[model samples]
Target: MDCIAMYIDGQWVESDSGNVTDIVNPANGRVIAQATRGTAADVDNAVAAAKRAFAPGSAWRTLTADDRAALMVKAADLIEARAEKLAVAETNSMGRVYRETRYDDVYAASGAFRYYASLVHELQGKASAENGDMMTVTVREPLGVCAVIAPWNYSMGTTAAGMAPALAAGNPVVVKPSSLAPVATAMMFEALAEAGFPAGSVNLVLGSGGEVGSALAAHPDVAKITFTGGTETGRDIIGRSATSVKRYSMELGGKSPFIMFDDADLDVAVDRLMFGIFLSQGQVCIAGSRLLVQQGVAERVLDMLKERVPKIRIGMPLDPDTEFGPMVSKRHMERVLDYIRLGVEEGARILIGGHRIAEGAFGEGYFVEPTVLVDCTQDMRVVQEEIFGPVLTVQTFADEEEAIRLANGTRYGLAGGVFTSDLGRALRVCSGVNTGIMWANAYLEDTAGMAVSPHRQSGMSVDGGLDGLLEYTVLKQINLKMTPAKSGWFAGME
Candidate 1:
């Protein structure tokens, strides 16, 4: 049993309290490995190291932008070399299908680092003339020490999402990965170290949110907190960081809606609709949990989904042919099942697979069959709340206006998509829907240069593009006076 230890000041060390947490393989609920459980004291050590590494005149802070870019590129290269190992670790630890973890998670993480590496050179300030006698110039400076909290669903991706930008901006980061899936994150720390990052420049502290996460949020030395998790937890971090008035960026929960109009190509709609909800077992924050279809085509679409969704392969994550894997844990699976029960009690009709699938083949793993609920109203809990599972609720609308109303009915506004061949209808629906991210004919297509914004209660943060990189920095204005002060204005008072 190899137990992973905390990485601080560029060294692997045991927890100060000697506490440990077990890592379970979601494929079969096996306790595969152990990880040291960090505490407040451990957080303090890592944060102190980050602060020191980010202090003025430190090697990390004094490096030129191009120098930092080169280091980031090197880190990216290291990640590419270890891609296969990282993919296996991620899949084994978190139950993500290898088909996805191998390509999307691993390479996407590497791409994030490389994207920021390229963007580091473009981190330029602005200058403007304030009349002829004075000039105002603005420059972006790195925030001192940043605490980056990663979510379990896409542990490596979210970790890279937060850490890459912070590093590119010359800010040292203290990362606290989710306890449920910290193995790949630890491996990433190893790769970064081998890539020659300065000691203490990038640190990792592994533990539960109540202990390590809270301490990181409230630490006085931390200048910013970047978090990706549930809405309630995001609220807690925001409140905790308020004590120090520390800047924060968060990508939280979403109950995104996928609208299919009568004009949509039925073939494309069916495929995208299924993948939009079922991909990653619907653990994604941007999962299209709500499916709003126009009344004219509702029955046809539901018929296609009902026939296709149940056929999705459900088995171990490592199986090359497995299209869907088990839920992350027994507790999460039960939570989703409970939501299904609630939906039934509220009078929604179950259209497809629903219930736990554990008998001869499941081997006590956390598995839930793909579920669909029809005859759902906008007010139903199943439609408005985030199930965070491979459960889709079908709701029909009479027209475009009704569809827009249904899509915007929820409290969340993270993401939504509109499917229609009519460009005018697509544009209209996309504009009327009140979500941070909107797609006319696609869903969850991401690149480093595009910004991911969450609206309303979904979250408050910047997660992509130049704005994402700029979130790790502070802006300062420099005003120079080229002319002497006017003494005549005060002559009367003198």
Candidate 2:
């Protein structure tokens, strides 16, 4: 098996601890690669390199915005050229379908770099005259040594989303990808290095969250931290960053609602319903796990789900024909299974699947049936909490008010969807929900120009678009005295 190394100071190197963790293929339980497990010492070295790179007169810090953007464009091109390799690595490590990794993940990663490159000039700050005697010019400057902790599910894409903006803002970055699926992200570092970023400008460290992630969050030299993970972990990162008082952008967990009205096109609603929850086996942070259907059309929606869901192919991630794949790991599979079992114990009816596939060719892999539960209440744990798996809990709402109530009932406010042909009703629900991102007649669709700002405990700060690019920058005001003579206010004392 190939061993993935950490990229620090523009070179691929092993961990300081010299320890390695096996990277398993969730499809067949085979060890496909090994990632060097990073430690606090390794994180310190990476951060030190980043700090040096971001120093006032260093090569990285001295580059103009256009120069950095040009490098990002080259990186984007390289990423596109290496799409197949990256897609395969991602599928092997994380168990997402081949088509998704190839078409969705790879493009999303390259697109982020390209989009941020185009907006690098937007980091400009305004200048204004405060009285004729004094003028204040505000300029945006890079925050030193940004630390990005990317999660396992959408590893490469999410890492690029954070890193591209930070780099475009002229901040050197040290990224720690989740150890469970670090291979593709390590591969992406090759493109960054070849794009001619200054040494130490882009670095990668692979390990568990407890060590490498914690080190990055708490490192005094790291000026900012961008994290995408669970809510509990986000809280921990906040505490770790408190000592340094570092800036943080967190994209955390969600139990987003998919509201389907009685007048919604059943065909469209059913298709989007599946896409909203079952995409990536429902491992998405913005997965619409709560299905809130209007009472008039509840049975029809359930019937359509019953007819369509079983046909969803559960096969190896590498298979082109496979529509769905296994969980990211055995442990995660168990967690999902526990939630399914709990849903049953909570008196919810399993309308479709609720069992793990442990027989036949799937015996060695971590496979669970795509599950849908009906007769569920809003207060149940399975409905209220984020399962982070291929499970959807169904609830019926009597009217528009109830639909809005169910949508905002959860503590999370990340993303949600509203399916209604009624323009007025859609707008009302869109406004009523507490989520950061809401879609009408669409689900799981994203563009490079839009920002996703998590609300409540879902997370803090912004990700994507021009706003996200600015998150890596700090504002400084330069005041100039227009007059040749000093102010008369202090001259009276003299």
Candidate 3:
């Protein structure tokens, strides 16, 4: 309730220069509260705190795997107990439907914390094939100080995606939550500390992405940087990491395609398509921005979507009756509007809502009516670029090959889905799509099951499964020579 302050090194501290940024309610252009604006100096302090906590002599370094897991479980419990309040703040800030904040986001964060917590003791090493008396082995070691940069759309969920794994791997973290939704993240950290984490183990800072964010990415002490945001921002961060050659993992921007084949269940596919893009007012990274529908089913699916996308109630997140909320900010909402305009100008047909939803009985808020554009082309900016709003651009495909071509046309490979009754087609499309993850018969859904990125844009690692835990650690190889033999050291011994 109080104006939120940043948490750093087990203490709540305001910005060193007394800078502050107002947290606005996107539903209406109203300043909900003001948080202390973080700066480069703040990043320095947080990074230093993480460094010390990850140092060889620090208390955090000596904790047992069970001890770390215990803390994660405790933090999740605390968040669960306060789910109502946390859900309200998160929904208000990010414009998720109440059911989502109350169930999807909060539950996922809780499950992730527990999932990574369960992985603490699972960091097992392997013994390699040995020759004679010589032996070799590989073990995973902590990456030391980790800097996590989270996005505004799913502030808590994305924060958990990076932080939980790092903490589970025994690495200390310096967290930079998106300034747009700092209050909820600060609250989450407060819960983390309350669960008895050591001092300097977790820290939070708030500010514009370009300022404190760049400092976090480029800091010499930060051993790893995990980021989730726009692709250009990810590119910039990767470039910045060159200064220190730090290890980095990115869940960058996605323009995931939602493909529906002629054989798919029209009712189910249409429902998921509506939910996939319009759930958080279409402000999700994997929003299924490019909806690829087979030619035959296109008209039927479009009819169903036309009714579904608009019927979703657009109002205050706090209202129990409201099903959808506003976008994060007026600027973001305006940009989405501009994109809708561009889509029309580019010859994409407007099938459903495309303009801003004017003030209703509740009055002022940045609400855009759920917009759908059909007759989309692959080269169109609306299909190729990420439109992280509750807007859908539909494209018709002639067959499975055309669908695959249209789906893989975008540069993004974060996520996509295939809706079909034929198992062969489902398997074929799933295998053919150039994406980190592909779901059959579902869209915009996530599970603890992980996927490996075959391509580079989605990154070189995986999350959600056992492979996900590797992002927080490094692989080291050790060799032993029981024979005390040298490999022709003096050109004599062989």
Candidate 4:
């Protein structure tokens, strides 16, 4: 078996400690490869390399924006060319269905690189004409070395989300992918290398969050930290990076709301609502896990879901007919099961499926039935907290006011959706929801160049579009005297 080694300072090598972790195929519990277990020493080396490459006179620092963009485009092309291999690897390691990863994940990863590449030359500054004799101009400068920590669930796609923008802004990055799924991200760095990125400009360190992740966040040379993971872990990274006062860009946990009003097209609403909560087994940070419906139409929506949930296919990721795949691992599957138990214990009624599957074509795999909990109160733990699984809580509201209140009740505000044919109500309810991104009559409708962000505990900072590129840069102002210096005060003194 080929070992998946760490890619640091432009080379793939084994760990100095020779510590390795088994990379298991979550679909079948098979050990496919061994991954380098990076330590603090490994992190130190990667950061030092990134710092060196980002220094004033280094090759990466001297490259023009257009030249950098060309390299990024090349990397994106390479990724597109190898999309099939990358998708299969991601599905094998991350446990997402190949049907989803093959197209969505692969294309999104390549598109992110292409998106940021197009924006590299768009980093513009402002000039102020207010000062009569002085011309003031603002310049965007790279924030030097950055640490990019990506979660396991959407390994390569999320990694590219952070890596592309950081590179576009001319910042050297040291990436630490979750130990569970590091293969595809490593492949991404390889593509970058082939595209002629300067040595050490893009580095990968694979290990647990406690070891490599903490070291990278705390490193003095790292000027910024970009992370996407659970809220608790994000808080920990914040505290760890405090010593250096490093800038942070995070997309943390979310218990997003999906509301269905009485006037919404029942067919469209039901289809989208099912997809909103169940995609990627509800592992998405922006998953609409909390459903708030108007009382007049609540039962109808529940009936629709109850009939639709059973039709979803649950099997191995490689199965073309499969709609739902195994969870990331055995532990995560158990965590989700425990959350279901807690929901029942909290008085929420399980309307449909809510059990672990232990028999079938892939009995040993981590699989959970699509679950829906009804008769739920806003204060219930199942409704308020993020399950990060294929479980959703249903609640009913008497009026639009109550719906908005219930929707915004959670500590999270990452994303939400409001469905209704009444444009007036949709507009009003969308404005009332306290989320960073809101959907009207639709859910999870994403474009390439929009700024997708989180408002509350869901996270901080923008992760897409121009704002994302700006996160890796610092603004500096220059004031120039175009004419001779004024002498009124000096003349009076003379």
Candidate 5:
């Protein structure tokens, strides 16, 4: 099969060690392709190239903002043109449904580039002459050589979310996609090159997170690091980059809550609830894995779930009709299964599904039934921890206060949802929950140019809108003296 190579300095090349890792299709447990397993040496070379590209007066650094934006818009167009090819690559590599990869992931990827392109001219800084004797001007400059460590779930989407803003701010980047899903990201990089990005301005390195990811985090020349992954891994990256005092933007783990009140429209709530958790087979970082339903309507919600959960179609990722696919890998599937077992041991009841699909053709793949556990407590391990799979836990709350308490019980504060027809109650709960992003009467809606930041341990810095673009920049102030004469106080001393 095809072996995807690393894109460094605008060329595809093998790792110095010449090693490769097989890219498995999670749907059938078959190896579809191979990606070059990058090493520390390769990371160093990529960083060096990025440093050169970002240097003052270099081809990439000297380009005007309009020039950069023009190129980015072209890249976005190219990505749209190759949408199907990129989507198929992502689907085969990560087991997300082809429709999601094509319509959502690919569209979001190009949209990020286009959005940031539109904001390139907005990087202007302010000036003040309030003090007549002195004029101060503030300007933002690009940080040198940024490293983006993307997660496997939304590889192309997250990669572009980091890279597009960095590039728009005039920083060269070295991207390290999770080895589990790197093929599509590699293909997306090809579009960047074809759009006439300068050599070394955009680079891709593929390998395990432990090695290549760590290397990128600790690289001395890397001015900043943007990462989206597990909380523990994010902590490790922070520690690794600490010695250099580097800047970082982290979008870490989340166990977001989906709170449903007794007065909520049952049908609408159920549909959004399924979309919130079951989409992408529950691989989303912001997946609404915890369901906090009001006690009065708990049984009704559970009954609706019991009826609807089985109707979710699980099949091959490439099939357009498939609503769900296998987990990203066997190990991840087992981890999710173990969590289900633990929930049972901890006294939660499985209301719908809680086992692997080991029958017939599904036996060859890593498929787990979409599981929902009822009679769950706030302190249960499954409720407290992020399972990151197709499993969701249900807990009943007595009132609005209890619902808010259960929602904010977890250490994570990334995203959440509140379903209620009562505008006052919805507003109260939305304000009460400690999450960064909250949806009322809706779920999983992210508009372009909106900013989001982690509230608590979820992460740090901004991930969207004008603030995200500014994350790749450093501010400097230039002070101009109106008079070149020395002050009288110093003159007296002289």
Candidate 6:
């Protein structure tokens, strides 16, 4: 196995504390690489580097928006050039399918950098004359050193999604990828340096969340923190950041609901459902894990899905026809299997694939078959919690209002869908559902348009589209001299 070094400041360095961990591929369970475990000391070095970059007269501080954008564009180009290598690295290191790395992950990751490149020019400064003789104008500046903790579900996408825009906005960042998938983040940062980001402007810190992540959040110099992970982890980060009163953004766990109404198109619902939870092995933050089908169409859809879900070809990540890949790790697989057990205990009928009792196709690596549970209820544990696996719970809702209520009832409001032929009902349901992203007549499709929002306990505001790029910015209102009028009150009093 290869030794994966940690990236800090502007160069690769061994962790100060000198702890190393072996990274296992969830696909067939092999130690693909090892990474240096980081501590507070390592986090400090990165933060200091970023702080220096953010300091006045530093290269990062003086760079023009276009200049930064150009550099990011270069980074994107380099990523594309190195696509095959990075894709394999990501798949082996993080257990994502190799094809996904080559296609969806790479596209999203590289496109984000390019997208934000052009967005640099869109940062508008506002002017207001009411403040004083000087007209006030707000300039959106970087939030300083951002401490980001990405989740295992999306090692590359989460990192690139948050990091690109944050960097494009001129914020020097310190990113901590999920220890589960640190190698992928390391690869991205390595490519970033190769792509020519200024030294200290972008840094990666690795280790456990307890050591590196929490420390970054609590770091005095770190200004803002953006994390994508479990909901409980998000809550803890929020609590930690509260002490320093630092700006924080979190894209926490989501138990997204997929609803297919009686009047909806079956083919559309099935297609959307396939992409919703099954895509990425159902390891998406917004995976439609809780599939809510209206009573009128529940049986038919379930039968269709039962036939469809199993037919999905699963194999090696690099295989061209591989439809499903392995989970991130064996530990995650165990968790998923346990949740499935819990689902059964809660009286939900397992429609397909449950036991991880060690059988054919199941080897050392953590691999569980994509499972579907029918006859589920909102009160059930499987329906409520985030399983974060290929298992989906199917529930039947009575009417539109009930569907809305059930969808909103969960603690998560990250994403949900309502499929209906009736456009009017779709619009109403979209408005009523407490989700950040809602779909009418589809699910998890059109994500390009549906900017990822961190709704309710799902965490904070969005991190996609105009809102996403804007999150990295802190506004400062400026007052310009409109007429150079004297202060009447102060002059009269004097």
Best candidate (score: lDDT): 5
Query: Which lDDT tens digits does candidate 1 get at residues 202-295?
Result: 9999999998999999898999898988889999988887878898888787999999989999888888888899999999999889999888
- Which ranges in model 3 have alpha carbons more than 4 Å from their true place? 361-363, 452-460, 481-488, 491-494
lDDT string for model 5 (1-494, tens) is: 67899999989998988789999999899999998899999999999999989888889988999999999999999999999999999999899999899999998999999999999999989999998879999999998999999999999999999999999999999999999999899999989989999989999998999899999998899999999999999999999888797998999989999999999998999999999999999999999999999989988888899899999988888999999999999999999999999999999999888999988888989999999998899889999999999889999889999899899999999999999999999999999999999999999997879999998889999989998899999999999999876666755554
Give all candidates' CA lDDT scores: 0.89, 0.92, 0.84, 0.89, 0.93, 0.83
Q: On residues 87-135, what C-alpha lDDT tens digit does candidate 4 reach at each position?
A: 8899999899999888888888888889999999888899996879789
Candidate number with the higher lDDT (2 or 6): 2
TM-score of each: 0.97, 0.98, 0.95, 0.97, 0.98, 0.95
| N/CA/C clash count, model 4 | 0
Q: What lDDT is reached at residue 29 by model 4? A: 85
lDDT of 6: 0.83
lDDT value, residue 56 of candidate 6: 94
For model 2, what is the alpha-carbon lDDT of residue 394?
A: 95
- Residue pairs of candidate 3 with colliding backbone atoms: 27-365, 281-390, 282-389, 282-390
As for TM-score, the candidate ahead, 2 or 3, is 2
As a TM-score, model 2 comes out at 0.98
lDDT of 6 at 69: 92
Instruction: State each model's C-alpha RMSD to the native.
Output: 1.7, 1.2, 2.1, 1.7, 1.1, 2.1
Which residue pairs in candidate 2 have backbone atoms (N, alpha carbon, C) closer than 3 angstroms, thus clashing?
A: none
